[model samples]
Target: MHSWPTTTLPELPDTPARREPVRMFDPSRQAVVALTEPGQQRASMYVCGITPYDATHLGHAATYVGFDVLNRTWRDMGLEVRYASNVTDVDDPLLERANATGVDWRELAAQQTALYARDMTALEVIAPDFYVAATESIPAVVEAVEYLLVHNLAYRVPVSETVPAPLTPGAADIYADIQAIASFGEISHLDAAAMTKLFATRGGDPDRPGKRDALDPLLWRAARAGEPHWPGSGLGDGRPGWHIECAVIARGTLGDAFDLQGGGRDLVFPHHEMSTAHTSALEGRARDLAPAGARHHTHMGLVAYRGEKMSKSLGNLVLVSRLLESGYEPAAIRVALFNHRLHQDWEWFDTDMQAAAQRVAWWRTALSGYGGADPLVFLDEARLALRDNLDTPRALAAMDAWATRTLELARDGDDGVAGAAGLVSRGLTALLGIML
Candidate 1:
């Protein structure tokens, strides 16, 4: 799959490499923990990608940009980062949207995925090292599923009416036996009852008979009529399930046990939880979750509009592409999103864009002027803030203070002041992901 254009990260002034380790909230541990081990200089991340049915909304932008901050933070700290993300190009939602709009599913996925790539480019998000689509990983998916089956970690049940897949005359749908995996619920921290409730609403069949446990997620869906299908296992033509697709893709590209498993808070439950379970199951670990071990998961809060969480089902989307087309600078839109912390869920107002645009204008103007204060101090503050739980609000505050000081104390014939301004501009680009 073709990915978005990569933004060239501007280099900071040559100095000693930064040594701060990033600390983020890990749901499993219920505490803020350092991402890197002692003396570790390499990191990996696997953020779940968009389904691409609806494409780059503000909610979508918030998640990717939030992770982009993490990417920038790790690099600024002199860590080698290997990142992977996926596109659910073949799914029920994608096919349903295509059928409703009278377009082929393949063309729809391609067009929307391309648009998502463009939006990420506009937002200056660093591209993932591996941007896999579910359709592209059938062989790996089949291999992973087979591993579980051979290990007796997964089982087969009758193909049901809920699945779009056609019944394999004698073969049943495959599922990961959650009962067999002792660590299934470790990631979400949700009790069995809570997991069941969420699973039913978020694509689980708790009432389905013959499931080893009510929470067992589908491993592979059998071949269906008028929908995408691939040869998955001996059960006949099928497609991989949501959780399994992520497990294979992340493990395939990033290797086993990576640093982070990140996405929106909505994914905290069955999606992240079950995927982590699948990953652990494949590796023969009976009681572990995620490639990053415990506290390895992070999630951005949902973006809300009109007192409701922004979603395609709600029909109240504020798209990033539309905002850019309406004359808002991409950097300004980024500033608008960054005004809040990663896990802070807040509602959007039109004033958000207005304030961010003004902020961008002021920063641009300040960066081009001269000042006596050393800009590197605030640059350090910016890095510290981001390292501490990806604190975008505090990081932006540091940027604002530097910009104010720069413009307020401009002086003539001072090469020192002129050099300070240039250094501060580069600092913002490298530390805060602001190109100004």
Candidate 2:
């Protein structure tokens, strides 16, 4: 039996009135709104993790950074947060990468996952409370699928060579009752035509012979020759599909219902939408049980390079490892990413990094001699900005102003300036996850 994390996290200051309200963009609501109820003391988050092949690119960094900010803000507000994320160590991309390199898929997953951990640590992302991997949670995944099958929410379909060439090889089981979830297309906001196109493009086998609906996603993929496989109770030797891994892991780590579910904008469709459906189906049958529903569903904007979206396929990825190799500080990389709204798509440029580096240098110099003071005092502007839908650019602007004022005061020989500057330094660490 997989159990929720038992390790305790340190509690922070609990000044409810002093903490600023936190608002975030909700794709489900299609508007910015308060993310938590007033005076709520605990929060939980689940963000989709990477597949660990060509891992830790700028796009990945930005997505993780966006959620990291939310987690930090929640904890800084004195809310205990249970954050769970998955490492998709046994996905198609990992298999394909391993096959191409003639490396054992498991070895490749382990190696790349270690590299991903290093990148995230260097970027100063707070470690998730529960960092579950699909391979390790295979038993949980299989059990969840069996539940869905017994409830009639999912069915096993036969696969044959005559299936469309684009369909995933050996995919056999699918979630059948997609219509059960109300507002299904509202989250992604995709029309029939666009959703259909993206579904086919993003691993959806819309035209699979026995599927009831075009949008139905594979729940279990029967094992094929040369593919990684696991034995299900009665589902045969195959790996779980992309969407089910997260659903199972989230339930095991953070209970069925959690406060937040987040991922990159690209996942709003088949990935997030389908995952929500599967979880909802599970809740329907297990009526006496807790429902795995996210109060807010959020997505970070895609990071692009040279007028194209950063992706492994486009070969336009601005990898974090490469950037570190080129001598760019992780702090600067994070600041550059914070330059845009978390929900707005933007292109990455060399100039952005240069500007962020300069900002970091200025802040470091400004706060150099600063000692200790209440970090919350210098955080008004930053706090208010962040409270407003995680307005990072505005928070950064506030930080710039804080830096300027502190430097001016210090130049004028103000006695309290050093302490104030120190507060600003600590506030940056708390609010922005940046160490000055």
Candidate 2 deviates by what RMSD? 3.9
- Which 10 successive residues of model 1 have the least lDDT summed? 286-295
70, model 2: CA deviation in Å? 0.7
Off by over 4 Å in 1: 14-17, 160-167, 287-295, 370-372, 411-416
lDDT of 2 by residue, 1-436 (tens): 1212232223333433346668888877788878888889999999998887776788899899899888888877878888899988888778888989999988888877888888888888888889988888888878888888887777878777653321455556545556555546656677878888999988887887777778878777877766778877677777788888888888788887888899999898878877876777766733323224687888899988999999988888888888888898988988998999877788998788789999999988777766423344457667777788788998888777766766666677764433566567667777787776
Clashing pairs in 1: 166-223, 166-224, 257-291, 258-291
Q: lDDT for every model?
A: 0.82, 0.77
Best-performing candidate as measured by lDDT = 1
| Tens-place lDDT digits, model 1, residues 1-436 | 7677776676765433257688888887788888888788889999999998886899999999999989988887778888899999988788899999999999999999999998998888999889999999989999988889888988888765564546556557798988776676677788889999999988777887888788889988778767778876465788889989998998898887788999999899999988888877888885543333323888899989999999998988999999999999888988999998867687888789999999999888877755545776777788788878888999899888877666666644443454777788777777766777
TM-score of candidate 2 versus the correct structure, residues matched by position: 0.90
Q: In the order shown, what is each candidate's alpha-carbon RMSD?
A: 2.3, 3.9
How accurate locally is residue 410 in candidate 2, as Cα lDDT from 0 to 100?
68
